[model samples]
Structure formats: C-alpha cells, structure tokens
Target chain A: MPTVKFTQALKRFFPGLQNMQAGGKTLAAILDEMEGHFPGIRRYLLDEQGRLRKHVNIFIDGALIKDKTHLTDPFNDNSEIYILQALSGG
Target chain B: MKTTLLLGTRKGFIAYEYRHGAWQSANLSFEGQPVSIAYADPRNGTWWAALDHGHWGVKLHRSRDRGRNWQEVAAPAYPEGAEVKDGQPASTRYIWSMAHGGIQYPSRLWAGTDPGGLFVSEDEGNSFELVTSLWDHPSRKEFWMGGGRDLPGIHSIVVDPRNENHVHIGISCAGVFETTDAGKTWNVRNHGLRANFLPDPSTDVGHDPHILVAAPGNPDHLWQQNHCGIFRSVNGARQWEDVGQPGGPAWFGFAIAVADDNPLQAWVAPANSDETRTAINGALCICRTDDGGRSWQEQRHGLPQSNCFDIVYRHALTSSGHGVAFGTTTGNLFFSPDKGEHWQVVNNYLPMIHSVQFAD
Candidate 1:
C-alpha cells in the first residue's frame, strides 16, 4: 500500500479528503483509488480526455511523475504519492 | 421591473439587489473563484454559477435559495470520440453562455461552451449531455477557430420564447446557427454577416458574432454585436444587415442589449477597434438607437468620458423592462433606470465582470 496526500485546497471541494493509504502500482491506479475515497475527485485531477489537468501535478515519492497524458508512471508499494494543484493564475 | 443584477466576475458570483430605489450588494458566493457566467433561470428562480477554475476545470453549481447555499451539478462533458479536429480530443473548456429552455419546459436548460459545443439538460439540470447535431455540423471543423479565447467558444444561446425547440447560438469565428427542431438539425444563418478577417468578407461562415440577443417581443428579431460591426436581422436571422456606424463608436463594441418593448431600441458600449479594445478615445460612452438602427444617440451623462479604459465584454451588458445595466473590464457597473438616457454607478470597484443579467 502507498500513502496518498493531497493539497489542502482540495478539501474545499472534497471535505472528506485526508491522508490515506491506497493500494496501487502506478500513479493512475493510485488516482483511481483516491477517487474511490472521494467520489468525483478524479475529474478535479484529470480532464474529460483522461489527461492530467494542465494545472494538476502528481508526485510519486517527492519526484514528479513522468507520464501525464498516459499516466503510466509506476510507483512502489511504500511510495508516498502527493497530488497537488499547481499554483497559477490571478 | 427586473430588480436584481446577477454578476459573474473574476473574483466570484455576486448579486446586487435593487431596493429602496438604489442598487446594493445582496449576496456573494464562490468568493475567490472565477465565475464565467451567473445565470438566474426565469422559468424557476434557480441561480446557476458557471465557475472557471484555473486548476480544477469548469464546474457548475445551482442555488435554489438565491445564493444562500449551493449544490454542485454535473457540468457538461464532451462525449467519447468527440474531437475539435482530427486526433484532437474535445472537452468543455469554458461554459461561456447558458439559457433556460423556455416557458414551456421548466426542466430544460441549455449551455453553450468553448470548443463550440452545446449541451442540454432536461431533468432540472441534475445532469447534462452534449448536443451532437450542432457539433457534427459540416462547417464547424472547417470554419470554427479561436476568437476571443484560445479555442472557439459558443458565447451566446437564445431560446425562442414561442418555441423552446428553436434555439439560436452564436459562436466566435463560426457565425450564427439556428436549430428549429431543438438540437436535431442546425442551419447556418450568416448570409449578410461580414468576416473581414477571412479572405472572403461575405462568406457564409467563418464570422465572429461577439454576442447574439433576440428581442423578447419579436422572436424573429435578432441583434448581434459582431467582431466586424453591429447587425440586426428581422426575419429570424435569415439575412443580417450591417447597421454599425462606419466611423462612429457604435461600430466595434462587444455587447448589445435590445429593448424588451421595442426591438428597434438597443444599447451598445463601444470600444476601440479590434486592435485596441479600450474605451473609444479614452472616453467611456453608451450608444443607444431607438429608431431601428437608423440613428444612434451617444449617452455619456454620469459616465466617465475621459481617460477611461473600461471595455464591456459580450455578456456583461443586459436590458430588461425599463432597466439597462452593464459591467466593464475595469470593474465599473453602471445602471440606467430609464433605458440609456441616464447612467448611475452601482459599483465602482469589483472584480473583472464577466456576465450580467437582470432578474425579477
């Protein structure tokens, strides 16, 4: 299992959001797991095209995920996943 | 008379109520979010805020109790296999315009979006599905492209009051489209519209209609502040006639509001040409035409006439009853109680105003 974390700003949308353990071997699977924890959260992270939203960034064990469009970046069982919204715009 | 001015701005969705003979802020929601459009469904008193989240993408929320509380609804999404162009997946980038179906259908709602897609909801906006007929129109791929936004957007949706099945939508770089059988089939209505930027200024498509508004009294009457100029159509957009003043301030404005009683009467907040979007000659003025675009009277009383750079967006100007109001890029909200004769400041400071609509 991997520990998943999210930006605090996400709590405004998904009030039940919190640090949780998700079982997955890839970033995409982990996001899917997080979506299970907070229904309708996947859209906040990914667009309708299933690509990582332009302003969303996902980190696997403190390193930026390499695959955004495909979401194929793999992770370890003990990896700490951090889903963060990029700070941009006025 | 419409007494509430609903504003969707860069900062949030705000409501300014007209009470005690003066306009004052009444409610505020989505405090720091960019609300692209704030809509009050005339069929029912539901307040909808189309939020353009920089990070989370477009989201929709409706308040049944007039902004006291809100519930997020499913935003329109581009269906699978949909594409802006070959190999380019389509998605709803922005909810630019929204309209209630008509007096006939209480549950029906329509949304026009960026990437040139129209969506409809029938179950009181609980969910929405894309209207594919207009999306599959032949000219869409060949003619539609970015105008004011990075992608072509459907900025206006006008539902015929007589027939909820009939709708006219305005798209930047794509001209006007009318669907008489609801969303079943669409016909291009750009016969006399001129797209100067295109190689053929008189083309049947590839025109930019900044905003399209239909006269409530005459569903056949339509007014558009096009990218090239202002135009009016008397026969349900069958043939548009350019009514823009060649060398006057009424030529290059973004917003136009036609009077409810008289389709001939209208108002426009003029800006400089496409090259310069600021107030004309650094002077903010409102132009009104009472005789069916034959002549326009410029109104500047109680308005800043010097060193002002305010520009009114397409959806920021609205006309209802005897009230006319508009919000500017510089956060100035002006209201005229008796048409365009006089202007008064409702707010001199607010966020970049995106949309304004009056409610009863």
Candidate 2:
C-alpha cells in the first residue's frame, strides 16, 4: 500500500479528503483507488483524455513524476505520493 | 425587492446584496479558484458558478439555497475517444459564459466554453451535453485564439426570449453564430462585421466579437462589441450595421450591455485600441447610446476622471432590472442604480473581477 496526500487547496472542495493509504502499484492505479473513496475526484486530478492537466504536479517519494500523459510513475508499498496544483493565474 | 451582485473574480466569488438603501457583502463560495462565470437564476432560485481550476480543469457548482451550500455537477467533458475536429482541442478548457435557456424552457441552461464549444443542460445546470453540430462545423477551422489563452472561446450566449430553440453564441476570433433549430445546426451570422487582423478584413468567420447582447424588450435587436467596432443588428442578426465609429470613443472594448426595457439604449467601456488596452486618456468613463448606438454620451459621474488604467472584460459588464453593473481589472466594482446616468463604487478592492451579474 502507498500513502497518497492531497494539498490543502484541494481539501477546500472535499473537506473529508485526507491522507490515506491505498493499494496501487502505479500513480494512475493510486488515483483510481482514491477515486473509489471520493467519487468525481479523479476529474479534478486528470483530464477527459486521462492525461495529467498542465497545472497539476505529482511527486513520488520526493521525485517528480516523469510521465504526465501515461502517469506511469511506479510506487512501492511505502511510497509517498504528493499531488499539488501548480500556482498559475492572472 | 433586493438586488444581489454576484462578482466572479480571478481568485474567488463575492456576493453583495443591496437593500434598504445599504449594501451587505459576503465572500461566499469558491474560496481559492478562478471563477469565470457566476449566474443567479431568479426563476428557480438556483445559483450557478463556473470555477476554472488552472490545474484541475473546469468545475460546475450549483446551489439551490443561494450560496449557503453547493454541490458539484458534471461539467462539460468531451466523450471518451472523441476525435479532435477542425483544429479544435479535445477537452474543454473553461466555461466562460452561461445563460438561462429562455422563458420557454425554465429548466434549461446554455453554457459557452473555451475551445469554442456550446453545451446545454435541460435539467438546470446539473449536467451538460456538448452541442456537436456547432463543434463539428467546418467553419470552426477559421476560428483562432485572440488575446486569451491558446484556443478560441465562446464567451457569450444569447437565447431568444420567444423561442428556446433559437440560440445565438459569440466566440472570440470566430464571430457570431445562430441556430434556429436548437443545436441541430448552426450558421455564421457575422455579416457586415470586420476581421481587421486578417488579410481579408471582410471575412465572415474570423471576426472577433467581444460581447453579444440581446434586448429583453425586443429580442430581434442584437448589440455587439466587436474587436474592430461596435455594431447593432435590428433584423435579428441577418445583417449588422456599425453604430459606434462615427460618434463613439475608440470603438474598441470588451464589454457591451443593453437595457432590459429599452432595446435602443446600451453602454460600453471604451479602451485604447492600440497595444495598450487601457481607459482612454487615463480617464475611466462608460459610453452610452440612447438611440441604439447611433449617438453616444460619456457617463463618469463617480468614476475615475484621470489616471485610470482599468480595463473591463467581456463578461464583466451586466444589466438587470435594477441597473447596470461592471467591474474592472483593477479589482474595482461599480454600480449604476439609476440606469447609466450616475455611478457609485461598490467595492474598490477585490480580486480582479472577471464577471458581474445581478441576481434579482
């Protein structure tokens, strides 16, 4: 199981959302597991094409994810995944 | 009766209520997101807010009990494996504008989005389906991005008051389009509009209409604030006639608003047309036309008279039964309780105002 953490900015919409342990071997699998707990959450994280949005950044174990389109970042049992929105606006 | 001003800003949404000769404010809903459009439907007491999360795509939220509580709805998303057509993107960027779907269909709502698409929701704003006829049109290839982001956007939606199926949409860099048979088909309605940025300035498809508004009293009359000039279509958009160049200021602006009762009266915030798009002469004033944009008058009673560089966006200006209200890029909101004659600043400081609408 890998632990996934959401930023405070995302918690504003999902108040009950919190850091949780999920069973997944890849970043996309982890997001899918998270979406099971919080329906419609995946839409905010990924686009319609299942590609990572331009303003979203994901890091696994202090390392940035390499694949944005496929989201194939590998995760282990104790991996820590952090999801944050890039600060960009007018 | 009370008037509520819903201010959508670059940061969040603000709700201001004016009653009893005073004003009350509440920083309600979408605390840290860019709200592109906030519409309050008095017909069904439903409030809709379109939040553009830079990283998270777009989200649509609806509140039945005003802004006290909200529930997220299904925002417009292309079908899985949807093919990109005519250089249009495959995903929806943002919901730029939303309008109620006429009196005939109280439960219907129309939404315009970036990447130049139209969506409709028959059960209020809960769920939306893209209008594919307009999206797959061959003329969409002529559309291009203007001053906005990467793709062109449908920033204005006008539904005919008499018929719910008769709809009109205004796009940036694509001009105006109308459909008589609902979303089954669409046709270019940009006749007599100019596209000065292109090699052929008279092209029908590449013109940029900043804003398109229809007078509630007379649905046949349409007013447009274009990139080249301001125009009025008295014959239901069959043809447009330039009405702002001879007497109006600069003739380049983003916002255009028309009164609910008077089809011939309208207002626009004039800005310099060159590189720097700011208030003319550093003076902030709203130009008005009483004879359907033929002649103009400047109204700046309480507005900044000099050194003002604020620019109003297309969706930022709105007119309701109460009066007209508009916000600036400088984060200032102004209101005119007595039509467009006198003005008063509602709030001088907020996040950069993106859209302003009156919730009657």
Candidate 3:
C-alpha cells in the first residue's frame, strides 16, 4: 500500500480530500483510485487527454514524476505519492 | 441603467448592484479564480462563469439563483484525435467569449475558445460540441495565425437578435466569420477590412478586428474596433468603412460599445497605439460618435487627467439603455449614466477585469 497526500489548496474545490493509503503500482492507477473516491477530482488534475495539467505536479517518494504526458513514472506499492500545484506566476 | 453589473476578473467574479441610488458590491464568487467570462443569459437570467484555472483546465459554472448557489458543468472539449494544426492536438485552452442562442432557442449556448474552436450547446450548456464547419474550414489552417497570443482565439460571438440562426464571430488574425444556417456553413465576412501587419494589407482572411459588435436597435448596423482603426458597416458587415478619427486618439483601441437604443451612436475607449497600449497622453478618455461616425466627441470629464496607464480589453466595455461602462487592465472602472456625456468612478480598485456586462 502507498500513502497519498494532496496540497491544501485543492481542499477549496474538494472538501473531503485527505491523506489516505491506496493499493497501486503505477501513478495513473493511483490517480484512478483517487478518482473513484473523488468523482470530479481527475479532471482537476489531468486534462481531457489524460496528461498532467501544465501547472500541476506529481512526486513519487520525494522525486518529481518522470513522465507528464503518459503518467508512466513508476512507483512501488510502498512508495509515497504527492500531488501539488505549481504556483510560480501571478 | 441596468440594476446589476457582472464582472469577470483576474482574481474573481464580482457583481455590483444599483440599489438605493448607489452602486454597491452585492456579491463575489470564485474569489480566487481567474474568471475569463461572467455572462448573464438574457433569455433565462442564468449567470455563467468561465473559470480559467492555472493549475486545472478551464471549467464552467452556472447559477440560477444569482450567485446564491451554483452547479458545475462540463466545459467544452475537443473530441478525441482533434488537432489544431497538423501535428498539434487540440483542446480547450481558454474560453475567450460566450453568447446565448436567443429567445427563439431557449436552451442554446455558444462558446469561443483559444486555439480557434467554436462550441455550441443545444441543451443550455450541459454539454457542448464543436462547430466543425468553421474548424474544418479551408482557410483556417493556412491563414489563421495567432495575433498576440501564441494560438489564434475567437473573442467575439454575435447572435443576431432577429434571427437566432444567423450569427457572426470575430477571430484574431483570422477575420470575421458568419453563419446563416446555424453553424452548418460559414462564410468569410472580412471585406473592406485592412490588416497592416500582414505582408499584404488587403488579404481576405488575415484581418484582425479586435472587437466586433452589432447594434441592438438595428442588426444590419455593425461596429468593430479594428487593430488599424475604427470601422462601421451599415450593410450588415458585407463591407466595412473606416470611420475613426485620422489624427485623434480613437485611431487605435480595443473596446467598442454601441448604444442599444440608437444604431448611430457608439462609444470607444482610446488607447495610445499598438506600440504602446496605454491611455492616450496619460489621460483617460472615451470617444463617442453620434452622427454615424462623421464626427466624434471626446468624453474626458470625471476621468483621470494625467498619470494613467489603463487599457480596456474588448469584453470590458458595454452599453445599454442610457448607460455606458468600461473596465481597464489597470483595475479601474468607469460608468456613465447619460450615454458617455459624463463619467463616474464605480470602483477605483479591482482585479484586472476581463469582461463587463450590464444585466438586470
């Protein structure tokens, strides 16, 4: 099982978002699991093409994900996943 | 003057209500999001907000109870395998404009987006499908290039009041397009327009009309604040004639407002020029034409006299009844109760306003 966490900013739209443990081997699988828990949360993270949004970032075990387009960045069952927004510009 | 004014801004969506003889902040929604468009459908009084999220993609929300409650709906999307150019995939980038279908079709909506796609919703915006006739037009791939942004965007959608089937749209670097058969077919409506930025200034498809507006009293009469100058067409945009002051501040501007009651009357906010998009001579002013553009009156009273740097976007200027209002890129809003004769500051501080509409 992998533990997943979210940025506090996402709580504005998804009120029930919380840190939880999930069973998944890949980043996309974990996102699918998150979507099962949060119906509309997938669109907020990925675009219609299933690519990571330009201003959103994902981390696996404190390292940035390798692939943004395919979300193929590998993760282990016990790895920690973090989703955060890139707030660089005003 | 209308009772309510809706504003879509860089920071949020705000509404001001005129009550007890003064305009006051009535409500604020999407307080931290970039509301690209705040539209109030005249047919049903439903307010729609087009949010442009920096982290997330564009989203649409509607409020039937006037901001008291909201319902999030799916924004328009490009079908699978849709491509903007040969190798680039197409997706809804930014929603630049939105318009209601009309009274005839109560459950209709139109949306214009960046990367040059027009979306129509026949079910009151529950879902939207791309108008592929215009998207797959022959000239779109070759002549449609970006104006200021990286990709070409459609910023204006004019739904004719008399007949809902007839509509007009303005595209940056792509010229005006008209549809008479309800999006089944589209024709280029860029005759008598100039595109100085192009190598050939008289090209048929590359002209950029910054803002296109149709008079409410007479749909045949149209006005556009072009990148080169001000233009007007009395024959329903079949041909455009340059009507801007040759040596005046009205020569270059982005926003134009036509009075709803009088087809011959209109207002435009004057900017410095294309090179420097600021207030003319550091003084904020609006120009009004009452004699069908034969002459223009510069309305400068009750505005900043000097030391100003404000540029009005196309969607930030509006006119209805005897009222006219404009919002600036520098967060300044001005309103006139008597057809631009005199102005008053509605709010000195606000976010960069993207759209302004006078709604009841």
Maximum-TM-score candidate: 1
- As a whole number from 0 to 100, the lDDT of residue B358 in candidate 1 is 95
Question: In terms of TM-score, which candidate is stronger, 1 or 2?
Answer: 1
Candidate 3 lDDT, B1-360, residue by residue in tens: 688999999999999998886679988999989999999998889999999999888999999999988899999888877888998888888999999999899999999998899999999999999999999999999999887568889999999988999999999979889999899999899888989999998898988888899999999999999998999999889999999999988879899999988889999998987998989889999999997788899999899989999989999999879888899998888889988888999999999999999999
Per residue, candidate 2 scores C-alpha lDDT tens digits across B1-360 of: 237889888888789988776557964778778899988876777888899888788998888887898888999888765544543337888888888887778878888888777888898777888888987888775445554546778888888878878988888878889999888988889899988888988886888888999998998999999888999999889999998766347388999988887899898988888479898889888888889877888889999988899989888887886588899999989888877689988888788898998776
Q: Rate the local accuracy (lDDT) of all candidates.
A: 0.91, 0.84, 0.91
Candidate 1 DockQ vs. native: 0.82
The digit string of per-residue lDDT tens for model 2 on A6-86 reads 888877677789999988777888899989988888998998889888998898998989999899878789889999887
TM-score of each: 0.99, 0.95, 0.98
By DockQ, the better pick of 1 and 2 is 1
Model 3 bad stretches (over 4 Å): none
lDDT comparing candidate 2 with the true structure: 0.84
lDDT of residue B218 for candidate 2 = 94
Give the runs in model 1 whose Cα sits over 4 Å from its true position: none
What are the DockQ scores of the candidates, in order?
0.82, 0.73, 0.72
Candidate 1: tens digits of C-alpha lDDT, residues B1-360: 699999999999999998899998999999999999999998779999999999999999999999999999889999878999998998789999999988788889999999889999999999999998888889889878999998889998999888889999999979999999989999999999999998999988889999999988898999999999999999999999999987988999899999999989999889998998999888889999998788999989889988899999999999888889999998999999888789999999999999999996
Candidate ordering by lDDT (highest first): 1, 3, 2
Lowest lDDT block of 10, candidate 3 chain A: A20-29
lDDT of 3 by residue, A1-90 (tens): 889999999898899999989886778888999999988899899887788999999999999998998899887778889999987668
